[model samples]
Target: MSLHPMCGVFVLLSICLISFTTPCYGGNILVFPVDGSHWINMKVLVEELHARGHNITVVRSSNSWYIAEKSPLYTSFTVQIKENLEEFFGKYLKNHLKMEREGASALTFLKLTKDFISMVSEGHFLWCEAISEIFDDPNRVKSLIDAQYDLVLTDPAVSAGVVLAKYLKLPLVLNVRWIPSGEGHFAVAPSPLSYIPVPGSGLTDKMDFMQRIKNLFFHSIIVLQQKFVVGPHYNALCDKYIEGGCDVFSLLQEADIWLFRSDFVFDFPRPTMPNIVYIGGFQCKPAQPLPADLEQFVQSAGEHGVIIMTLGTLVNALPAEVAEEIASVFAKMPQKVIWRHKGERPSTLGNNTLIVDWMPQKDLLGHPQTKVFVAHGGTNGVQEAIYHGVPVLGIPLFFDQYDNLLRLQERGAGKIILLADVNSQTFEQALKEVLHQESYRQNIERLSRLHRDQPIAPMDRAVFWVEYVMRHKGAPHLCTEAYKMPWYSYYCVDVMVFLLSAAAVLLLSTLAIFRFLCCSRKRKTKDKQH
Candidate 1:
């Protein structure tokens, strides 16, 4: 039965309306990062999303892998350096050394290095430039969106992708890598560590008087150095990438949802904006059996069991002194120690100490012989530890590590030691306390149960929300309206109350002046008549 032309037109109109109104299969997510910490979560999310029948295309940043692949010797050297350091630290600091705390310091050193490296080298800047170029290209993003799929989910690292989303005028979901950028303000209302100061405080209360001055001096130096030393190089890189101006921060504000890879187990600030959602600890899965070698090592160590120490991926290297301190502590401990380091150790290792450059941390943590985690307190590490119901001795280095570990201690899931003065004795004491204390283990167990009891795994929740965006016309409901208003309007005190108050003051001042002038003239006339 061939349809008439009129009937065909009606059928076509119906299809168009359904396409507009009905939900799409949850659209493709463009995740960045070649292969590192993001690999675990990103893989889990993409796989789970696919399982739920959503299409996903991950455009990995091949930068790190490329470097390693190109320079095998360098990579090996890096690994050797790490392993040596782990051995040294484990053997020396075994007395009472806080492995996690030292781990934190190591992390800070790495971050400090990254800051300097980014300044000295052109690699990261060049990558940014390349991204900017792609964004600046005409209709590149629009073409991609039009070719297939409905919304775009991006990590904040892809500042260029944010711009692309803006250009395409599509809904965007920001998959928060760890802590949201401005979460210090959100998590702790009166946070003193203000990178971007809140208004009226004059950037004064943002830091102590000395720190503020130091920051100013440091910023001035950086700006001057950039102008003289780094700016030209960066500009060359920028020239290669960005054609037109773009605001990366603005793109963050424009995102439809800021989905955090965290749970209430860590930092649970009451949500100020509807768009922010905490879905942390989602990547942690139930424990699987350890490999034969690791299992054998644990078995050989006997009844006291072993402590697992890792500083996470970024801070594989440690200072020699710190490394030695860790090694010294491990030498004194009766229990076996497994340390992950990336340097050469000067000290001799005891039979109880196992120093390796890398360990399957989750797998090790899940081991029945594993008692405590000595860590740098990265969210990923913390979550994994918690999920395994293991307590941590957190040595926070910098960034959110301090805050993250602090919260852990507060939650009774872990304890913290200052990174500045950590030695074998202190590290050992902290470790002994963590291992012996029943509360630490019990507290973590409670957190672990709560973490596992979530209605669905984090991946499922993440995928569901992503799909929800497509089903509900870009998840308009998830978007926050806070950015739409001026800062004053957000509190309903700026334009509304402030203007009203100003008007009242002006009217009162005018009336008073008029009355005063009238009285003065009347008094002068009366004097003249007299």
Candidate 2:
């Protein structure tokens, strides 16, 4: 008996669904995320992998161990550190703000490099020690080795993760929180300093000769410092724990995959390798409804709209004088202000402003009545603003914050005011321009559309690539030939030297022959005269 047409269609649909939904065997994965914001940023990807039926293990701080415990699919290993990392960060922030108050002139490239190296070194040493203590227990080492993890995912910001990967003898994957900086250059394809601005240089791709020279100088200094100073320090720490010596620079260069938290839309154009993936807005989700109190406050502004100001968690508060100046500006503006302040309430704060300890920044930015975001130019904050179509007034504090703001300004989606230069007048004027200006809104809206126009959601793409790596056993074929070449060979220095030497010899030979002919002619003339 022949089947009905609709029945045949149903049979075909059933077959397709069965084929698509068939579950493939998942691999065991181990993740080592550094404490604080790095872990927070990576949690989403980790959770997704867990949901995909992969056996996932995470090594995190004791304070944040509960996060991993909440999920039944994840195995948690907590490390206790003697010194509080938060305390160190608090001290570092105080010093950084003090430097800003002193003047931007005092924030030279070398000083910033020194400050960063000191901070990262202290943090790295602590983290490495924590991981080493874990392996000091023979039982734990034997258990981890027996787990036979198919992949090791880590944040390259902390070299301890690389050492763990080395110890486990597993394929390494990098889940980076920012755009590829100087250290990243050695790992991936070559990015010429002439066009690709160094992380904190605050220059754009369209640099003039002088600016290019300055960028090149900073780039060279940073690379040298990482190689000569930071690399050795990390290597020593790694050697103390892992069996074979772990060179972080070599480990980074040999990484199987680099999942960056930035997209080309928000970054300058530069060369990248096949293994380098851009999953910029993976952390952003659809905004949820605001809390009743926040909704009421937002609605009270009527046609004027509301402004949200935050410097992220690390920077809980601004300098006292800068806070007062910003408060004074907000008081005169028509827009209602929501300031996430962790310090004493500013004396200059007016009725138009509401000071809170925390805020749902993405939800606020998504609100139609939310006019502008005043932020510290962090990657997460800026990407959220872009996703929600909110123009920014960036007050960059340190590190990649300056570069993030520079990109925003280049795209005409934001304006930057130096923390050292912020006063009532400057703050008021910049805020007014960004809020009242139609072009800022228009530019950001265009970018927002582009950011959301991807064929596949960023989270799904991230998951697919991660699984692809696992399924293909590290996907070694995707790596670039550049990774295999030495620095000199990759840059073609040897080829250039050979060509130059050959040309020099040819020129010398021609000159010598000309001199010999001249001498012969002169001798012939002498013979005739004789």
Candidate 3:
């Protein structure tokens, strides 16, 4: 039977609609991504770019843990670097946890900071060397130059991408949350200590005097780290490779766009730059069918519901005692627990809990049976919890975990139990509160609705901005000239001083004139009297 004329018209219209809605792809993109968990999100972007028909080339360190040497998503150009920092990071996490257990004494605090600074310095040094090697290799350098990539996309946590982008003179886009110096906004936006809290400060946007003092001190430490610790390594590379030596902070600020991994829903409101695009929870989606066995476990909870716990991949597991305490609490709970734990099994393991190396985190959170998330408070985890509207009982470990959880707690969507205070009593109480409280669920669900109520999906927004940069060649217009200005000039301190000086000089001249005129008048009166 022949198709009706109207049916043919509808099919043709559908094709035109589909074509117009999607972007024409095949832009050449060069990705220099930081490995480990950073790679997870970067890979998400790579996949989307690939689907959009873009050609991508990723630079990977030979010692990469999570990033593979071979991938269908993108081809990797591996650089050999001695010493795997993952092992160093693992050891640091263990010792750091041990120190926390010992107590937060001055000595322990100093030791922890010293180790942290050393690890940070070492990681930058290795990558700086790797980028240096790439620069020295005539053939590879030529190949990169010849490729004529439209832009350089990187995670600014490591300074290599920022530097490499400068060296290549390509438009740069940062998949940024943390820069080498500090948080992304501190470099690219006008962040005031009065309101915007520095990371690691443990202060929220609404801070009192003492909290502001703490925030200032934290800001100072970040500046010191930039100046004394990570700066020299990249500065040396910059001096050698690029015409004018550039600091990591400056290079980071110069990026055409920042695909910020946070949204205002998750982050406290503060100053932001136009170039920064908030793509938080972009990796999230509707839950797929759970693996058969995992589905069975989740279903077994029945009306009680399931509690999902995962503390990220950085640490193998919490110290045995902490784990035992947590496990015992899970055992007592009516909710079935699915925990991603990878050490000696906790002695208090209960039939209600399932221990696994990994569980589908996003899937679990999206599941209706999942009640509360017990997490380490990583950005990905916290944002995912908010995305799924799952209330969180956070046991923040290190880095920005505390601050991430603090946002949730501030919003009443989550509760935090510090590692130093993670005994069975605290863990059990916190878990019970989150699991039973209707308010927590309501707040988070509201947040989820707000997150979904965007004009466009975050993933599409990210890809659009990436292609935006590619189309525009560079987005210097969107970038602030503030980075190029020194602090005194940027804050208009010179202008302030100039205005104050002019006023002071005018006042002095007027006073002098009055005194002289009064003296002359007095002399003339004396002459007349004589």
Candidate 4:
């Protein structure tokens, strides 16, 4: 009954071909990303997962559907929501722009906290409604439930993803685009208010007593708002949609992993839990050859090098006068300028300046001739600049931008100019100092080396952890016990209170005993005299 030699050879070759050509199977991953930087920041991780043979489905707005559709690597599903979050962001930015134009002082730390709370609250409700609409459609819900995704990856900035995870019974992971801030503190390890600055407070890790008090005040206020106001709103959404009462804070606390877009090299030293992974330069890639036109302009400066300026997608247009003032400063410098502008071209743009609607920012920064980056201090822009060892001239607008620039200045890798204070002269001086200072370049270059010195690239680390979670089914083992402790217990407030009360009681008992002894002795002496 033995097979012929030719038949056996044919079977062996067929098996080998199948093994070589068949795609390896990885677990299914569902991503729920909001618009703008949150969406852009997750692009690299998503692409990497797709490349590694994982099934990824991105649920985003129709406006950005093309982002997921452009690549056959993944599937994209679009939902129609009446309220556009970007429009709200645009309005908010306009208010800041107007204030800057009118020369208002930079937002105080308290004011920034209030503004941030409002922004998060508004976005939470808007996205909740949008997500509910997607789930309300019976067909979409059925399709999603049938898919039975292995894991849910999302930006915790919006809580809709939490509800979706609950609906599908999937494990959740947060792809935080910045250092763990206000709400993020609850999810990761507990960061002490005494040292860790409240997000957007613009305070560094090193703080005096007064600064610590201010940080405490702001942090407490934000926590209160999240607990009382934002948490309830998200809970209501969960109740209506998922038939379970889950709030934003609780969902964040339960997340299996928090992949923060930060590294200790760029950030001040702070304690992080095992579940918190620092993948700061996840989006950074080696520079590709510049487009022909961009190469010519960048090369035009030759020995002088080039300065690249961008305000990111959110802050596209500056005030007319402000734009002109910035342009004038570029004109004064010998370096060639590549400015990413959205509105009308600045009238004062110099011959050495090239204005484009958009540019490949990472590629430009990675270029050898890239001397300095003039940016709005967005997390993506700052990280890209740091990855490429380019010093920054940060003109902070709002949100984490102020804190990011403050950190850069502390590191001596960059300088900050308040948008309100950005006139031609100040801009020129800042640019000149960054370009001329050898310390700026040296420090950033050292940091860049440290950034890339890890055993695995940040994106690879991200993909590995994602697959780890899928394989382990939620990774509850990695979660810290800090999440189980109540806030007061975690900070040892109750322990401190008990110790203080015990000391007070002991002092009172000692004084009472002394007083009684004194009274008894006086009575005995009086009786003896009688």
Q: Highest lDDT: which candidate?
A: 3
Q: Any runs in candidate 3 off by more than 4 Å, and if so which?
A: 1-21
TM-score ranking of the models: 3, 2, 4, 1
Candidate 2 — what's its lDDT? 0.82
In TM-score terms, candidate 4 sits at 0.86
Error (Å) of candidate 1 at residue 323 is 2.7
Please state the error at residue 187 of candidate 2 in Å. Answer: 3.2
Model 3 TM-score is 0.96
Q: Please say which candidate is ahead in TM-score: 2 or 3.
A: 3
lDDT of 2 by residue, 138-236 (tens): 988888899988888888877677778877778888887531225364457777777888776788998899999999888887777677756776677
lDDT of 2 at 288: 89
Worst 10 residues of 3 by lDDT: 244-253
lDDT of 3 by residue, 1-530 (tens): 99999999999999999988865857999999988888889999999999999999999988789889898988888998888888788888988998877687798789888988999999999989988888999999999999989999999899798889999899999888998887989888988999999999888899999998899999999999999999999889989999967667778878999999999999999888889999998988888999999999999999999999998978778899999998999999888999999999999999999999988999999999999999999999898899899999998888899999999999999999888888999888888898888999999999899888999999999999999999989899998888888889998999999999999999999999999999999999999999
> Which has the higher TM-score value, candidate number 1 or candidate number 3?
3
**All-Cα superposition RMSD per candidate:** 9.9, 3.4, 2.3, 4.6
Candidate 2: TM-score? 0.89
**Cα lDDT computed for each candidate against the true fold:** 0.63, 0.82, 0.91, 0.82
* Ranking 1 against 2 by TM-score, winner: 2
TM-score of each: 0.70, 0.89, 0.96, 0.86
**Judged by lDDT against the true structure, how good is candidate 3?**
0.91
Q: On residues 183-250, what C-alpha lDDT tens digit does candidate 1 reach at each position?
A: 32232122233343321122322367666666555445543543554345434433444455433444
